[model samples]
Target: MKHLSRLNKYFLKYKWWIIPGSIFVVISNIFGVVPAQVIGYAVDLITENVHVYNLFSGFNRQEIVYDIFSSNLLYFGLLVVLLYILRGLFLFFMRQTIILMSRHIEFDMKNDIYQHYQKLSLGFYRRNNTGDLMNRATEDVNRVRMYVGPAIMYTINTFVLSVLIIWSMFDVNSKLAIYCLLPLPFLVIIIYYVNTLIFKKSGKIQERLSDLSSFVQERFSGIRIIKSYVREDYTRNMFEIQSNEYKKDSMSLVKVSALFYPTMLLLIGLSTILTIYIGGMQVINGNITAGNIAEFIIYITQLTFPVTMLGWVTSLVQRAAASQKRINEFLDIPPDIQSKSNDETEINGHIRFENVSFTYPDTGIQALKNVSFEIKSGEFVAIIGKTGSGKSTMANLMMRMYDVEQGQITVDGQPIKALNLKNYRGQIGFVPQEVFLFSDTIKNNIAFGLDQVTDDEVFDAAKNASVYHNIIDFDEKFETMLGERGITLSGGQKQRVSIARALIKSPKILIFDDCLSAVDTKTEEDILQNLGKIMQGRITILIAHRISTIKNADKILVLDDGKIIEQGTHNELLSLNGAYTDLYNNQLLEEETKGI
Candidate 1:
């Protein structure tokens, strides 16, 4: 219910529909009672020996009674039909309105969540699972939609109809009405307890469902690894365990729900029996008329429906509340990064790091410490390091993936933090180690960001990356679909396509984060040579492990444990005979043995 309160703002926007929907429901309930009243009157007339015909005869007692019965019965039947039709019409429109509103709200919620994810630091994604976020955006939103639609309307229907029936009963005979209501308080108590239990259990069920979805998603995404290691049987067993847990939780919920209808029936049965017993005695003792007793019985039967509906609506509301809580939890997490300025500034590609240091948010272990460097405009620099060194962190810092805690990083002598994020990001192009390509034509992937990139521009960039010939070899050429994440392409081809994407941006500063790892040495050399020719006046930062990749750079750095251990030209570092020199010697000897 508290979760539902948050929906008040959205509900307010659609109140124009909701208000009329409620009015129609009230009218339907009011007309719904008429048939019962008509039945009571007819029964009383028959018991009093009234004629079924001759209602048009002049001024006779029996004729008057017949007229009353005939006219009232006709009107009551017509009212019933009319209200039922109105109820259906209004309910259809109401559902449409509410569902439309829910969809809009869901859209807004998902967009906000996605936008928040974009603003968050990389560390946030490292700590969360992709499947859980997808579940929240998809399944949780659908649950909210159900609540706003049927759950809301049915709840209103139950309350309004129950009140109308009860008040009608009292109008007929207060004593009989009280006896009929004897079971109500207990029914309310049971519903209250059931709602509480449903909320707690449904929350657990949703969590297990999320875990199951995550398990399945993770396994499917890594199916290649599973097959490579011949772990299919093990993966199947793990999936079975997760599925069984989800099944057990769902069955428990079913068990709880199964009890609700029967308990409602029991209470309804008891209330009806008591109404007959007491009202029949009152009629026989002349304390009330036969019509009153008949009306009381009709009202008693009507009471059961709303009571049963109460249970149904209560269960739905509890499930919706549980879902709302999960959704709100995701929405409540503050982004780890926030853009502070919106003033756009032009970039000149001069980068400086002054005594900078940083640690990953969760681990608290320093990834980079007191590292400082400067790269002037148009310089080609390479960072070389062994695994576990701070090479990648330096590249990430340049892209502002995670901001440094100590000191400042400036581009063109202006602190990056002071510049607008969108403007700053536009000046740099990055090609990461992992290549991700959407399932689209090659041309679209290359021209993803630019509004109007000509085919010639795309082909020229691809030619520079040495992938244009391969693209033209395909049956569909540039229009060929790449399949999921470019699965159709070889690793080197995928890397080349990613490289072409970055090149198409024509950014002032280009970053290749171990981008050449997959390509052959010859292909890598050619691409580097072409890049060097075309990017003479642009800053280029290359992160690599191979000596061949960094040998031609103007300056090279050897990093270890978040600090620069050595920095110089390739020949100068080899002369030092340190970590870099040792690595170069091993690689040179290995290549010689292979007769390269």
Candidate 2:
């Protein structure tokens, strides 16, 4: 119950349905016992040809009023039919209202989880697998719904039915009731044991499902690599191994679940045996009529079903609790990065990283150490660094993907944290080294960031990125749908399309983090030529390894071993004849040799 309280807000939202549904559950059970009592009286009237009033008096009263219903089979039949009609009506309301509420709650919970996932920082995704998250969002949500819906409905039904039947049993014969109910405590002990096993097994089952889903997601996403490496058989065999493990765990859970029905039935059988034996003895001793014994037997049978349903309901509660725990773990995760203030301010793209030092979480190596730089508006600054020299880390920090551990990052003199994160990120256009495209049309991918973009604007951006010709060559042109991550396109084509995506945003700041690596040198130069014209007054930060790429920038900063070793224009760096000079000479020699 405590575990499920997290969803109280949703429950309260639909309490009108739940309250009325619960009333129907009680009402249905109250009238459901009528047919059994009526049958007992019918048997008594047939045996002695007595009036209904005589049977009601148990043939032990001195004064009995005869009525028109004497030996009346038709009247008893009509009464039983009316009682069942009422019971069926209440049953319909109970199932329709309560069960439907669960679906609504499930819908609400799934959206809530998805909305939360959208707000989580990038670092949270880095630590969790897609499959595990998907399972929590889908399967675990359904399990929790079972707890709030059918489990709750059945529990109420079982209580109401049990109370009604037990009272009738006591009215028939209190001694028989005592004997028949002796096994109930033992049933509780068994249910407790089953609940423990189910809780443990259900957790394992959900984990195995996540593993299987992860395996499938990875295989499908990397199908090209799998075929290129010729590891189809290996991948298939591994899938089978994972699938088999999931099957085994599921069967084990099923085996534990399978015990509940039989355990409840065993207790029910014992109770029934006690009822018959004691009930028959009471009748033989002339303590009660045969009708009383018949009614007692009917009440025991009625109690058997509700008692038996207890096992299933208990299992549902346990499984839901396990799922709730997994979901709560996700819901409880605090976002590592969030906007402290919602205040929005106009940004001029005047960025500064003042003595910023950052080490990645759980890593001993520092990604950035005392890094410091500034870029005024409209400056075409290029950052040159070898791999792992913190070039991308610098970009990530600028975008606020992760905050600095020391010092401050500011935009237009306002601390980055003080500005709203969404508004801050909206002003920057970033093209990362690894480009990702959705499985959608080319036009949609290009215009993804902007809420509204005209076809002319998309075409202009694509033309600027030098991808317009290639897109027109395709049969569907810009409407061509791509495969996962744009697998159908060439590497250079994908990079150009990604550039177009960033370009279409028309942002105040543009970042190209080694984005032109896959394109040929001539094409890269042409794209940069177009970009230079479009970036007249916008702050542009270009991260590249090839010296030729950033040779004509307004300023160049050389980073090595997490520090700024040199900063100058290309001509000034060449005149200094330092690290930048060495890199330029090596690249020049390689090109000259290639020409030969």
Candidate 3:
């Protein structure tokens, strides 16, 4: 229950529903416990000629009624029927309110977790798997909702009914009540141990479920690779192994749960048997009336349901607590990056990195070391390097995906940190080396970030990216739906659409992160030619492996081993005959050899 404290805020939000619902639960259970007393009084009316007035006065005085089918008997029977009707009504309203409140809370929790995931930094996603996070948001949230709904309703019903029924039994015969309830303390002790085991087992079950989910998600996502390499049997065997682990954990929980119900029933059955034997002995001795013994047995029978349900209710509570703990861990993690600044100034895209250095978290290798560069507004800068040479690292810092550790990056003479991240990133358009598109229409994918993009804007951007003709060739054209990650499109087509998506933003700064690698040389040349016109009066940074891609830029930077090895115009670097020259000569030789 203490683990449920995190939901206090939501409970407060929904108090209007919960408070009345709880009252109804009490009312319903109170009504549900009244039948035992009614039956006892009716028996007294028949056997001992005890009238209703004598029963309420707590006496066994004999008073004969003149008529057997009197108005009083009819009225008492009607009252019992009305009590049951009220019980049903109150139970209905209680379910309507509390159960619906649980659903609403589940909805809010799912939304909150999704929004929190959106706000979390890239590093958090890197640390956690998709299936684990998905399970926490969905399966774990549902488990918590069970605690707030059925578990709460049953627990309250158990307590209230237990109290009312036990009170009625004490009124009938205190000695009988004592003998019946003496075994209840041991039931509590049993529940205490059983619930602890349930909590432990439930956590393990959820964890194994998450592991199985992750395994399934990964295997499905990579099914193409599995089939391509003829590893279907291998993947299936791996899946079976994970499924068995989940099954073992589930069976362990089942074993613990299986013991709980029978144990509770045995204790409850023992108490009931003891009550009957003692009350019968008392009746034989004339210490208590037959009506009193009848009423005591009825109350104990009424108590049996709530007592037996104790084990199940405890399981729900313990399971919910375990799930809540998992969910709270996610909610408790502080994001590694946040936009704390309130500045709203528009950016002019004069970017500079001064003595910048960065190391990825949990990795000892430094990605960039004292690397620095400057690009004024309207300048075209190109970065050329081998793979893992900090080319993409610079672009990431520019986007503030990860902030620099040693030095500062500034835009328009303002520190990048001082600018709100959302606003800052909004002004720059980026196309990564590996393009990703949503499973949506081509037009929507192209105009992804921008709202209310017109047909002209979409067509013009597509043309500028040299992909408009390819789009129009399709029957549905821009309206054609794509498969996941645009798998229906060719590699070159995907890159072109990605470029068009970026171009549609009409940003003041554009970054091409080796975006042309998939396109043919002729199409690449045409795209760059159009990009030159679009790059006018806007900062452009090109990151590429091809020497031909960056040769015409106003400035070219060559990097190696996380350090900038050379910086000059293409002709100047060619004259220097250093790292840049070596890369150019090797590429030119490859082209010549291929021509042969």
Global lDDT scores for all candidate models:
0.83, 0.89, 0.88
| Model 3: residue 381 alpha-carbon error in angstroms | 1.1
Root-mean-square deviation (CA) per prediction:
3.0, 3.8, 3.8
Task: Give residue 303's lDDT in candidate 1 (0 to 100).
Answer: 75
lDDT of 2 by residue, 1-596 (tens): 67777988988999998999999999999889878899899878766655445566755442333443453778888898999999999999999999999999999999999988988877788778899999999999999999889999999999999988888878777888899899999988988888889999998988999899999998998998999999999999999999999999999988877877887888888887887788889888987778877777788788877887788888889889989988989999877788888777668899998999988784656888898889999999999988999899899999999989998998999888888899888888999999999999999999999999999999999999999999999999999999989987999999999999999988899999999889999889999999889988999999998988999899999989888889989999999999999999999999999999
Most lDDT-accurate candidate? 2
Q: Which parts of model 2 are misplaced by more than 4 Å? A: 50-71
Q: Give per-model TM-scores.
A: 0.92, 0.94, 0.95
**Residue 535, candidate 1: C-alpha displacement in angstroms:** 2.7
The digit string of per-residue lDDT tens for model 1 on 250-291 reads 888888889988988898888889888998898888878788
lDDT of 3: 0.88
Residue-by-residue lDDT tens digits, candidate 3, 1-596:
77789998998999999999889989998888787678777776766544444464643332334354366678778988999999999999999999999899999999998998888877688788999999999999999999888888788788888888888778777888899898889988988999889999999989998998888888887878999999999988988999998899889889988888888888878887898899899888888777777777777777778987788889998899999999989999977778988777777899998999999885667989898888989888999988998999899889988878899999999888888988888889999988999999999999998878899999999999999999999999999999988998999999999999999998889999999999999999999898889878999999999988888998998999899999999999999989999999999999999999
